[model samples]
Target: MSGEEGAVATETPLAALGETMDLMTALQLVLKKSLAHGGLARGLHEGAKVIEKHAAQLCVLAEDCDQPDYVKLVKGLCADHNVNLLTVPSAKTLGEWAGLCKIDSEGKARKVVGCSCVVVKDFGEETEGLHVVQQHIKSH
Candidate 1:
């Protein structure tokens, strides 16, 4: 193959692998993996503390959070600490992804409760999903 064609062939696999998962799906994978690895700090207060300490790798906020000040505080902290920030549409969905809510036998959240924020401290050995999430964050 020609030089240009060889480069394109090698790049194609990487591009495909990166695009295989959407942002939300990759985010969920990261949260789930982080949960088992004890890398997550659930709730706004805990998340803020993590960010303040510069121990956070990523911070996720729920778009439907009731407290605007808390969101702003976390945003500022993330910026100050150079941590990546992401937002999901619903707190309930975020709670589920963060494993804050208990799952029922029927595969549903036991309560209507939700967590507004989560701080990711470590991605553990499974860094692919985290890498994907960080790439998405950087691109936007």
Candidate 2:
């Protein structure tokens, strides 16, 4: 085999491995995985509780949260605990990703309005995506 062909064969594509997922999509994937594995906490109250307990691995907030105070509170908690924090554009989307939405007859997520915060206590076996997200946050 040629040298270039051998190198290409041994290399792994970042996108194929999920390393190329954007921050928002990575956050959603982590939330979904956490929900299924039992380490997800939804909403301000539960997220704060998790952060206060020093159990939060990552904290995700919605940029369009109606309550400024709630956003400040979660940001403070994340700062105090040194947990990784990320923000998405909308709480409704965040809620859907956090598994708070109900499936409609059309098989799409609906209702449940929005969630202001979501804490990921653990990423279970699917942690590479979360690590990539964390690295992205740290670099920015």
Best by lDDT: 1
lDDT of each: 0.85, 0.84
Q: What's the number of clashes in each of the models? A: 0, 0
Candidate 1 segments whose C-alpha is farther than 4 A from its true place: 1-19
Residue 82 CA displacement from its true place in model 1, Å: 1.1
Q: What are the RMSD figures for all models against the true structure?
A: 9.5, 8.0
Q: Candidate 1's C-alpha lDDT? A: 0.85
Model 2 quality (TM-score): 0.80
Worst 10 residues of 1 by lDDT: 11-20
How close to the true structure is residue 111 of candidate 1, measured as C-alpha lDDT?
A: 68
